[model samples]
Target chain A: MFLPMVLNSLNPLLKETFVNELLKCNERTKDYGLVLTPEGAESIIEARNNILNSLGRVDMGIEVALGLIENFYTSTFINEENYVSVLNEFQEIFYYMKNETEDMISDDKLICIIKDYYENLCGGSLELLKSCLEEFIHDFRRKAHTAEAGLGGEE
Target chain B: MEQRDNSGQTLAVQSKINSTNLKKSQYTIALLNESFRVGLMSREEINNIQIQIMQILKELIARYTKGESSSVCAYTAESILNSILYCIDAYALGCDSPEEAICHLKSLQISKLYERGVKSVSRWLEEARELYKKVRKNKLNVGLESYDHTINEDIPLYFTNCGIVFDAHNGAASIDYQLTFDDMSINGILYMKNYLEHLWIENAFCKYFNSEDIEKLLSDFGRTIGMDYKIELINIFELVFNNAVFAILAGIPEGLRISQYHFDLLSGKLKALDDSEIDKYICQTVEKLVKNMNICELNILDYIYRYKTVFTQRVIRLVRIDSLRGIILTEKEEIKKGYTILFENGKEMKIEDFNLFIKKLMKLKNTEDKIALIKSGIESLNDFVDLLASDCLFGKEFEALFNELGDMELAILAKMALYEEIRSDFRGLRSVISEKKESRVEWHICFVEFLKKSGIDRIESIERLLGEIDYTEISFY
Candidate 1:
């Protein structure tokens, strides 16, 4: 009840700020024949909030969502018909991978990595993108372990 | 409202109440709960305060992430919330009373209270640092590992690693050095500061005597407790203070050392007194001891007076049991006689030589030839223990070796095998070893099991011989 009250107080303000930011994304995406309606932006914000809450993550603002939209809107595979749903799924995967990576990757770097895999590697296949991210996380952990061992040996 | 007392008389409850029942560490929560219970605060007001705290947490999280990430994990948020609450609690404790703290909580913003708490923590940390310096300067020159580690390592690490912003409530140091009376209520830098202040007072009292005398007193106390003085975690001040009280009672008010003769004299005198007489004598002696020592620090004097009642009770109980010797420790006189068996470990043999010696011993058909080969071949104690562990000797051969060994050699083997259990009471060794069947090494168990099967006369001689062996002179390899 207390946690709900805290999130409730933060919800409306966060929704408004994010909705405004998502609508502003339409200005750039319109060049690629992509535009988000107010209803679509609201739905995206709601889905983002659900994913974040379910993952036990707190977001300061709509930066990561905006970053995802900015990177994926220019893709050749995305169209207006599948725009909202695809953005919602991308938000879910972004947060999941964020947690899986243990927050070791910065936001911008993680966004760049996700965008690179989605656009070039996975060819806009959501399932393929998820698997690629998992593999990337595994390799990252292995490399980190090896680096730690090297440092320990030096010490 | 009027409340009924135990006598069934009605008394009007006052508006203001004392803060005696409030816990200092949990001042805010305790005050809030108490105010709510007394009907001074409403449920709606408490909810509003919680909402304010949540708002403060939201802002803190945003600052923590630097406006980049929209959210953090639940664990991070909870840690930040606890830090925020810690700051608020620190500020609440600074108020004059629980009533005033509750009033401030209701009126002021949570952010303002958190800021004040942060400042108070910073100020207290500085004061604690100064107190630590004083404690180090006046530290007693005793060889206590815990004391030295606490002063040299733990406190310095705390100052270097304490996170005031995110983990203000955590007392970062593992303080192993114990005080005479430790307060476990308060926490964080406040607790550290209070601990240092009390330690300074205790160190001040101990500074009255020479460090060598205190060291000797600690050594004697450890001997009384059946432990080595250097490694034991005994409080130096408590030992010195208790012995000083006994020294005064023994008519040696000018010094701290109490000899065996002094203990005997005091034992006879204390046994004749009743409980009340013992109390009166101890109180007068403590007063005289304080005056003679010229301990002028009021804090130290108050500390000593506070422990007087407990000390008096302990003395009276010890007196009733005719065991005042537990508290009044006499100096341990070193044994002067030369030991019958001076066990010096021989030089280690080469691998080929050791194998050839074992081969030659095993080929011999009789036990006497094997014993002679061992006595001449196995030079080092390691090789001897290794031989016992090697299973070269069977049942009758083990008995033959035991028959050949003298009482002193058996005692030496017993001392090595049962190093921990071998105390002043040699009679308890058999039962202790039987209870603690496990030992440090494989050879130790084999040696002890053989010694247990040896006859009662041999066992009794080994126990008597253990009493004569000066364990300090012999080194176990």
Candidate 2:
């Protein structure tokens, strides 16, 4: 129904830029024995677009994907076998967290929080990490509500 | 193909350029649609504009998120997009014609058009502020809380909290003050500017009369509406304007004051004319008002003329129904002088005596004997009203008492029953008195039912007595 909006996400120029930017991430991840081929990078970009569209979000650049690749490349849980799929799942989770937090937390801070939960808390189990993040989001919302009420009382 | 008419002359082809085809508020969308429909713009050009709008949205979203996030929810994105279109609409409306606006849209960059629109919105906001200042300076010295809050809190809050960057088109205020001729088609700061400008003009016109007279006019208007003028959210300009027209029609020397005598005079004068005659008379009186008041401001004159048609129609309807008192307001002092009941409470009977009297009246089977006992016992109007309130008078007894009362006594009872509905001439009193709906007060319902069953001559006499009785002279003994 949103023809114009769908066309916007389908712009060839934007797709090309996202693919090229994702491919450049191999330069840093290759040192850690994790590399993404051009085709894999294209798939990752396609995954990002699908996730963003489903979540009713718009991304101007490939920052979220790059952040995921950079933050999780050093982890022992990521390998060549699971590299592309894990990055795709992390991209979806990252955008979901952005909406969950109401975009209050900064990009780098949110990614650090998620990486910490994935490594130390969930021991790199994606399912445990998802549940852990949900708990964190619930607590985050309660704190925000309390803070807002406090401010209202002060006013 | 040029076709020849029967006279052997070529027929003139009508151009498809209609200025009103574009809505004032949705100027950009309307202009682009019109442009594309007429082939002045192509699908490719329209798509390019949409793409450019998306690009601008991306830039704005970056600023909104402060680069912390690269995306926002679809609702936020759409809101930003509408704000962008709102700015573009502002600029397009500033252009002389839709064709000119479309030409600019095709030639200029979308960002540049948005920038120009932002500038226009900023200027309009400033103009609205100035108009608000003038409105505050010349505001009517009335006691309406809604009007005060609209001026003192709501509009100022809007100015302070309006997000010009992302939501320039949103009218972020809760305005409660109503104008007689408010234009609802406009939105955002432009609507606010228009409202304030119109309000300033209305205030300026009201300033022509002294404050006391305007205050009295509003009070009288409140009385007719059965509300406290201090709390009601009536448009002050409407009351002042209507009374000014009435004052002119009644041949008052000057000012916007209409006394009870003047209202009665105007009522009689209007009743003599038919519908068309009333229309013609009002039209001429409005013209005379403009000339006599020396209203030179074109905006004020235009504002008055804008309401002339509806006002003339209302007056004609009221006259046709013989309810001109609805528009013609009399001062409260004059109303007090006109309706005096001189009600003095008789000496209260001892509780023992009152209880015995009530017991004796309740025991009497005949309605006449029961009413006679109550009338002989209840000497004061208060006692009589209280006796009615006490439920001592049964169903048949109430009608029996009403039949026994003289015209003046019935008039007194009717006045108390229909006090709120009675304006100068008790217009429409019969309908109100005869309404079948039961009143919350038991005595009121019974009294109205009795009046409904009474003879037409009796009702007319009570209506006449309602006019002659001076309510202000009422005193308790």
**Cα-based TM-score, every candidate:** 0.75, 0.73
Candidate 1 per-residue lDDT over residues B177-284, each given as its tens digit = 988888888788888898898889889999989888888787676555444566566787778888898888888856579998998999999999999999999899
* lDDT at residue B21 of model 2 (Cα atoms): 77
Q: For model 2, how does the per-residue alpha-carbon lDDT over A78-132 read when each residue is reduced to its tens digit?
A: 9999999999989888989988989888888989998999999999899999999
lDDT of 1 at B408: 80
Q: Candidate 1 chain B, which ten residues in sequence have the lowest lDDT sum?
A: B4-13
Clashing pairs in 1: A58-B70, A58-B71, A58-B72, A59-B70, A59-B71, A60-B69, A60-B70, A60-B71
lDDT of 2 at B318: 89
Off by over 4 Å in 2: A1-20, A23-62, A73-75, A79-84, A152-155, B1-18, B271-277, B333-477
- lDDT value for candidate 1? 0.77
- Candidate 2 is scored at a TM of 0.73
Residue B230 lDDT (model 1) = 64
Off by over 4 Å in 1: A1-102, A150-155, B1-21, B42-44, B58-78, B321-323, B335-477
Compute the interface RMSD for each candidate structure. 3.9, 3.2
Error of 2 at B463 (Å): 15
DockQ (C-alpha based) per candidate is: 0.35, 0.37
